[model samples]
Target: MVAFSTDTSPLPKTKKSLQLGNYGTLMSSQEMPEEYWTPLKLPPEKRVTSSRSDLTSVATDNLSELLDETIAEEQTTIDRVFAFLGFTANPFSSYADDVCNNKASDMRLSMLSNISAAYNAVSISMALDIMQDLYETTSKDKSLCSSALIAGMIVGQLAGGAIGDILGRHMAMAVVMSLQIVGALITACAIQSSFSIYAFIAIWRLILGIGCGGVYPLAATITAESNDDTKDGGKAVALTFSMQGIGYLLPPILTALLARFVPLRLLWRIILGFGAIPGLWLMVLRLKNQIARTNSQVYKSKRNMLTNAREVPVNVLEAIYVEPDLFRKMIGTGGCWFLFDVLFYGNVLFQPIVLSAAFGQAETVQRGAIDSAVVSLLALPGYFASIIAMGHQSPRFIQSQGFLMMAILYGSIGVFFQHLSRHKFALVLLYGGTFFFSNYGPNATTYVLPSLTFSSSCRSTLNGICAACGKAGALIGSMVFVFAASKFGEDIVLLACAVVSLIGMVVTICCVSETVIHDEQIKKPEVRMRVVISEPSLLDYFETA
Candidate 1:
């Protein structure tokens, strides 16, 4: 019912050339006679009907406008949340040596690393219990069912990188963590209800794997970007990744405690359900702390927020395709990751079964839990050792050494399984040594290298691709190990893993480069400067001519 006016005053007369109305005529304002002037007039206004359909249309229009406004407000809130997480606020911020070396930045990255580790380890931890309870009793294809988690993870990791690029890392992480929470809750329910237990658990595990997969690249990339400026940037990144050791170490100890104190039947459900806690906490913190305060200040104006948002094109394909060199690097990094995980995840996921074989299936839950805990604990020192030595070592060297050592250890165990198993201490030492080397070398470096090699534009995607390759390898390895261990025996499986590690070592030496953290190479390009040229003078014009 708002009204609009269409009235206007005549323009003041021109001094000499007065414009005649669209007639290609000109007149002198001073010479033009007063009798020739005309007064301004407007047509009579008509009253329009406010019919029912018209009212309905107006109401609909008003509702649509209100909805649009609401959506805009919601989007602004989300942008602010992303800004708080430090992702969207400053698209062109420096990520040089000085910037990456900040104490605050390192701390934030460390927290993120820990959360990522916990998220990833959840499925593995649950796998241990599933092997004891459901796998043994269930009628379904246990290996295939168990491998579903890893398969889900592979898909999720690939999706996560693309999502991170398109949506921004903070937002992608939030969505990922939320998915993990949902997956965990569903898994807990499946455990509690006995109906179609194997199928339900397998489906839920896949969902959980997706969330875990999403964490890998994001955590590695964020940690690498944060620590890129420091002299110990690699050390910092390695330390952050080594947080996964703590994650691996926790489940056995937790399971041991639960077995001793709680009801035996409730243990698996409790373990599966507990994964939601850290994920929920992390998702909250990630959203809340996304953008830095300086970035928030810089982007206080709405125009700046819009501008910042536009700066980074969120197209994953464009990011990779635009830079062919980056895609080439992706092959090396992704390939190495694929090979490493074949050995690492394959062995780690089935470690409990290996232990059951070692100690006998008749071994009580508490003893099994304690022994697993003790063995898992053995990998921790290697992680800290890597952190200590990362500043001194090159990634290429560390990976090569780790892979070589793992091959040696695994080969020994495979070739002399009966001889080593006769001496329990020797067998444990060899098994734990493989873990130590894996953590110190390829496992840590694979995570760190991808972060440093690519431009920030496609770092997440590249990292995700690498991690997804690893998970795909994991899926293959897990399935292969189960089949091989059953048909060919554990010794052959171990030998196969040893061969895989050897292949990884060769790949590292031939394909992957020694990462050089050059500030200029990694830093986002500077905005182009437009030089203003002076107007041409007669001499300048003649000289040019």
Candidate 2:
């Protein structure tokens, strides 16, 4: 028979104070408080001598029984807690244990499903073509169309950014997707209506643009925050961005299909009406999966504090300005995007004119063939290269290098285009090179950089501001490209883009830092140093003592 020894011992009390000392300086004993120390009392017991073999067997049996009972109780407690929280206890409940054991295949599948669902609204290029038609029909004036489109872009980005902040990312995305559906319907109806169809289209486009802009920031924020690894976040974001390339590729194919099968006038209406399908589907999925995949955890703590507390909440502008370092970084990074937009959009908009001069303005199927083939082929390489680079390089590096390369390429075009004897193959090579490098650099940079730098809480707003700046740059670029081409020709306009690209390169080099690596350390020592130095009392003491 096994014998049990019953012993009673008092549990030790926790220490009330701790002493900390550096170098030879002695911290006060009173401050440390010796009274906090309570030694554990040993159990008073008389040992009964027994054979070693019997004692070992008895101890092992007792230890196994104790562990078994403890594990059972722990499992019972866990189940109760999970029940209270309304969470289903499944294999996924041990996500961390599974991850550690390299068994996260289900998690991976879930993430992929979420990504596919989120990125279903891939209609950017189709939307652009549809918008062009709306503007042309409504305004009958090219400049007004351009201006309205620019304004719409800016308004959409700013509103989207702000809305994403006020509401959660999921809510913002759902709202925008709903708006997109409405905008599409209104635009389709407005086209057929007799009353100022142009104004109606412009207004609807503005609403559509707002929704589109919101999607970018919200998607980026969600992708970055949801992933377990930063590298995974980058890959997820890159995949979403790759959809823009899909949109770019799809439209030309769509346009070609429409041209071959459908009438040109009906094409715009079909595109506009069809654009809502993806958005509506995404909205439904978002609603259905709201409980499982929402990014509420990211903002919940900050939001709870804001709601429960009496302290005044800082306005967006006030919060930004208060942190001057952050403000400068945002402005500088945003400025690079601004410059990138000018060069990128300017070149894209004026490509027809440049190609017309090189290949001759025939407006024939041959001309269309050459133009489509060249642009499509050039864009394909650039887009794929960007996706590949997203995983391997820092966004800042890609952006800065892209700007510098674009500046050089554009500047060279001015010098080289004049000398080339309008050889079709040679011109294609030059144009393709420009398109390839531009996508590789600025296009990828603009999208990637905004997603990387800002804190999750403020990312949407900052990205919105960056997007607004980008549109402003596009507006400037379009006006300049048109003006310069009219006054001096393509050479002058290309040269101007080169200068803007150079400025963009400079801004990126000076301001942006790599955000791919998670900086576990505080935001930068300089920011804190400046904060301390700026205090009046600190400055006064430094000057005197």
Candidate 3:
């Protein structure tokens, strides 16, 4: 076994203009971003505290400003609905796909924040071999140690979901990022001369895992929710997740460059310590905009826990139960993610093993390093292609297409194993296709779909659940590749991957929606008219200032 250790390490809210629930036909407006997924649906009536007297009592300036914004918001809603109905151009590309990036720095920052997860992997990949010797651990112990990191990440993802919904995205991001720095440093310093060192290392890796895993949902949802511009509506979100490709290549490149000069013991420490730098920088950058600005669309779209709780179920279970379609979507997204990670992690962790067998083992360190870097590099195009594809196709279409292509590719490799194995170049081409389709297909879509599918109130929570399932699949993929390769040989393992890919295709076709805009608009269009308002709720845009 090549020792599977380091792989796949991969950010809101507001109070309201209190006393504003369905004032008559007043559903939510475009101000509430969750409503942005589709046309605003007029909500059913609730408590009505607003009367003619109360309206007159309010200041004229406040009322006038509120009405102006509301009218503008309703107008935006009207545009989106007409666009959805094909009466106008797309809301995103209406003026020929002008990107909104110049205006969305906070969102772009949230997208880059996910790059920190890649740093966590670097520490483990660089330290693994050195620690095996220093700790005098058995191969079993080494594998277990790495598993500790993955386990921590898995648990952290689950908890992070609830924390995100409960505390808001920015706060949760800041908290977890601080924890990551502490965990990385502690793990770097775990170089004592005793068996206890192994225990110490494992504990800290687990801690780091929690921080790393928590970033997935927080960063992804932040970008997805904050994104307001793109000729291709989902391109921003796709770019956000595509950063993972750069993350995977970073550790090996760093290790290769540093190994020549640094002392072995000191080298591992430096590598692990380095993971904290990106997190520190990002934390400070994020704090500068700790909360979204009041006048911004990003701010208006927030899901308020204090004032909007009555409308947004804090508990995901309650939300799903109230709307069974949510339950079905949860299954679809979760299942596709689960299946994709199984294939992705399996292929990435074992690539070196397969490459050596096909190309013949490299006789020199330089050659081996080059091979590793090349394999990682090949996956980048797929990530880049997915961003472009997102501009034109629905996630449902992209995901299903990717899965079907992968199934065919894996199946072809399996059936012609003997012939392809003999032709090293042909086998290499086939192998690279897997990474291409994986990134282009379900890998990016799994993350993108959940962020857009659910309402802001439960977005992080739902996306967290979906992402955590991917981690669970990671554990299974890493283990399965080992057992199947050992027991049935590599050829059979490839065939089995094809089978899994086929199942993923089926699940995606049945479960995933065609597009974020159309499905949501057709299902729940926003409705608005001043009915009665209850003091229990406030207008989302009304700030005391």
Candidate 4:
């Protein structure tokens, strides 16, 4: 994200020679010799006359020849500079991996994605606080309105995923992130702009939701494509996805911190507006260096376009019909996400209410903050452990186990709610256990599996579909959790979540197959270079008479 710097420190002219290719190769041992240097010179010419038409033609031909030679030399010089930096003059040549695989850049992209995920959830926790200020609304209405934000996000996700596949992941991310910032700014200005709070907030939230929806496909696909092997690729992506836990954790920690210094009235605005800051920073980073920059050339190449045009589905609907096996797999992946999010978001978004019900609603803010912080802290280890496990274990196995553990935990929590509520420590352990399995299991795997399930041409499209399905579950979960809990009590909500988890476990075990991509298998589809140029493709770098 930082600008490439020029070395301003003085150096001996002899040492200033460019180093070419790998670490050991040097372009020169000494300063250029006067004889080796070419200087542009032209021979004196006589003006052509009417009687000397043949001479005139000869002079004109000589001038044209000299101009061509000069231009060729200039092009050769530029080629030498490019080659020294590991670029090719031959447009047909596939780029070298060294030019493409930047570990630091990839990690930075992951960090940006983490920020995006974090911002997406932060708004959920702050929704009730925002609604209270804008209007006097009951908790159920507030919760329903909040679900609309995530609904907008789902709509955005479907669009973003399709955009990534059709246009390019980088371009899609750029557009998504830009709109997220605008959404945040607009939300912040809702009061100042004098627009109806409901309409304005809803419109802005939708924009924010779109940005959030795009993040999964763009981040997951770009990381998968960038790394290209199950072991390293899986770990790289899991590491990126795990940052969402930190995102989940931050809202409570930040709210707790801000609550001490800021008044409640102004706090909601700050929280809503603050979401934009991360997106803005990430947008700047993405602009400087995009996710998977090297793939852009391959995506645009004539051969690749023709090949992809025939092989890759233009959209998920087309993909479902054209590639039946892929469609079935998409169903498994998307279904798992749907079931998991029904449990995950239901628990996560309404953690405060659940805690209030358990501990009694006194000091709601402090209790919610304390409980959220504790649960989130417990979740971190799971995210990291999953990152390590992703390298050694099968994603399907991990995901299935997670779902099973969560189902057990959810059932236990629901059955023993009265008994556990009497004992704070026991309740915390049960709550923390669910959070742990959620990350180590389906939550992380859902993101990774979708990226791997489909071909490169349709990876984002299918991922988007899978993710959109998950968001649909989240929207439903968020909407129903408040009403269901109020009408039927928290026990029923917990039991339903447990049922959802059990279903997810079954779906994962039966439908979701292990993603078995290897390095060699992945390499074939990527633009592969048959040769690595050791020196610049210029006449000066070659032996000549």
Best by TM-score: 3
lDDT against the true structure, per candidate, is: 0.62, 0.54, 0.65, 0.64
Cα RMSD to native, each candidate?
21.1, 15.4, 15.0, 15.5
* TM-score for each of the candidates: 0.68, 0.65, 0.71, 0.70
Candidate 4 differs from the real structure by a C-alpha RMSD in angstroms, to one decimal, of: 15.5
Give me the candidate number with maximum lDDT. Answer: 3
* 1 versus 3: better TM-score goes to: 3
- Model 3: which ten-residue window has the lowest total lDDT? 3-12
Instruction: Name the better of 1 and 4 by lDDT.
Output: 4
Which residue pairs does candidate 2 place in steric collision? 138-198, 156-210
Please give, for residues 233-266, the per-residue lDDT of candidate 2 as tens digits: 5555555565565554444555556655675466
> Model 3 segments beyond 4 Å from truth?
1-105, 133-135, 228-233, 284-316, 345-350, 358-368, 517-545
Least well predicted 10-residue stretch by lDDT in candidate 4: 536-545
| Order of the predicted models by lDDT, top scorer first | 3, 4, 1, 2
Question: Could you tell me which 10 consecutive residues in candidate 2 have the lowest summed lDDT?
Answer: 536-545
Give a tens-digit lDDT track for model 4, residues 491-524: 7789888899888888887887776554244432
lDDT of 1 by residue, 498-518 (tens): 888899888888877776545
* lDDT comparison, 2 vs 4, better candidate: 4
